[model samples]
Target: MLSEVTATRYVTPLREGGSLPGIVEADDLGTYVMKFTGAGQGRKTLVAEVICGELGRRLGLRVPELVTMQLDPVIGLSEPDQEVQELLKASGGLNLGMDYLPGSLGFDAKAYQVSSAEAGRVVWFDALINNVDRSWRNPNLLVWGGELWLIDHGATMIWHHNWPTAQVSAAKAYNASDHALAPFGPDIASAAAALAPLVTEELLTEVAAEVPDEWLVDEPGYATTDELRRAYVEPLLARAATIHERITLDAPAEDKPSQAPGWLSERLAPRPRATKNDKDGGQ
Candidate 1:
């Protein structure tokens, strides 16, 4: 279970996304980026964050610490934003909170160079979870302490939205052409050899358990939260075995044929070591 903290102060809204997640100070004196149950995406978004974020951590990926925040609607009474106030009023209990990374820079690919091995691992992990949000336009990645940290996993596991066809969706191929790490010539073969065996039933079961019961309560078609959890674990376990083969890294047709080959080859070509001051291209 995630550590729990009561929100002491709502600092400000991060208007970057539609969910309207905000920065808040907790009673434990820690700062977190809190995502609300009342946000348009609802508790399911929080569930995805926990499952994918924690799983990524266990798989040796860097992700900010996550906690369950106990929010009191009254904290928003002083807020001038009517929408935020209403959101708080509606989300008066448990919400998801990620430890705030101070002085983090958004990832900028053009400036920072990612090695093929690192890019392969990230692309493989994203494929396993069926994350559709980690695209070039909105990378949802940050650079803090000279490391890449993944965030905003609420867009993962789209099949969870419709249980009936989830199995079919789970079997579908992952199109990595638009993935943020695709340009780096991800070594999918190497990544699969290293990571696929790690995505076991036991591992996924443990990951699913990290999701708060409150978020899983009364999910349709499942009599209990544990049962609903199995629904999440099964697909991932099956997908992990063969997702590498299904990953399509082909460049999109919009790119001119001549330019696409040159661009990909250039990015993949061996280059001099990148300097520490080089830019990271993810925001």
Candidate 2:
């Protein structure tokens, strides 16, 4: 379980996220961005946040510290919005909180640069988690203290939504064609070589244990919470070994950028199939 804190105040809702998480002051005198279990996406979103955020942190990636927040419904009484009040009331118990990084700016490729080595680690981690939200349109990355930090992992590991086919979903290829880091020429091969061996069953088990039992209870097909936790571990362990091989960064023509190095730009550029006439020595 994560470090626990009690919410002392609800400051305001962060409208940027679809799930409507809010800023809160906790009893520990720390400010955090709290995600409500009562949100439409439900507890599973927080579950994913804990597992992925913690896993990323353990892998030497920068991730905000996470804590389990205990919320009291009365705190929302001061809020005027009916929707927000209801949401707070419904989420009266445990929720998720991420330490707020003050004054952090959203990542902008034009203003900041990422080394190919760093970019490869990020892209490879995203692939391992099967993240669909790290595309250029919504990078979900922040630049804090002049370093990159990963956040908002609620949308990763989509296979959990359908347990019966989780293995099948985990085995599918990851298309990084629209990935925010595609232009940086991520060295996927090197990343896989360095990180794959570290993603052991032991580490994954530790990560899974961070997810509270409340979230795993009553999962449709699983009889026990431990069973549900194991379900998450198996797929990720399998994906880590080979996901880099299937990564595709063939960006669409419209999204292609001219800033990449010649080698990377050529690799990311879509190629046309050679016609028979052209193949025959330009006959």
Candidate 3:
């Protein structure tokens, strides 16, 4: 879908993003936040976003629309002079874009002042997906148009490799008492139920088709496009309910006050029996 474009213009870089996302203008004149695979992290990151973000949207979470764009290498790297081009070249040869949320400020839980019920739903969803990006220090929530918007899904489903055999504790550290854990259990269960039926072969093929070949060309592990689709996209959709139920059952209770109001730790706390080396890999 992104290949139909002829050109794109790179704008400014988003300083807050760890991956150095850039703001860019697409051929249609829409602005998006684009993350690059410059150093080889692009394919995985972009694939994760497409699969998970789409699934999240289906589950009724507020995620911005994601689309792939063919970066005009020259436009992205172009600067006032050749000096700027060299600088851009060293950064990355292509760019990605996220739909821009105008006039939005970085999310602060206190700003939304969401009820504990709302917070619970957010917590449950994060836990279900094993999202490790929304901790107190780096709560990647945004407030635009008077609502909460979740962003940066690069850290979800990190345990997809052994998901069938993996323990819940291996994925996230959810407990019943965590304030962000309870409100959404019922809703999450319902959402998962609805999502399960939608993960059909056609849907899987269609969405996987949306992923750019440039992103997957060299990833040996995903040898074929079908393998890539099944490995990365289909499971999440097919097992939506199972995964949802598992996370809801294991999610921390909502009795404890949120340590930082709007933020919840994306990483589970370490177990006493965990080896020193087992510390917080998901975070």
User: On residues 2-70, what C-alpha lDDT tens digit does candidate 1 reach at each position?
Assistant: 899999999999999779999999999999999999999989999999999999999999999999999
lDDT of 3 by residue, 1-283 (tens): 5433323676676767766677778787788877666623445777667666665675567888876666545674445555334434644444445688999887654444565545555665676556777764577778888887878887776754444543443434543333232322235544445555665666656656666666656555557666666665544443444555554233343553344322243223344686556677645
Give the Cα-based TM-score of candidate 1 against the true structure.
Answer: 0.90
**TM-score against native, each model:** 0.90, 0.90, 0.68
Candidate 2 global lDDT: 0.90
Off by over 4 Å in 1: 252-283
- lDDT on C-alpha atoms for all candidate structures: 0.89, 0.90, 0.58
Worst 10 residues of 2 by lDDT: 254-263
The C-alpha stretches of model 3 lying farther than 4 A from their native spots are 1-7, 76-95, 115-121, 160-206, 237-239, 248-283
1 against 2, candidate with superior lDDT: 2
Could you tell which candidate, 2 or 3, scores higher by TM-score?
A: 2
Q: Which stretches of candidate 2 lie over 4 Å from their true place?
A: 255-283
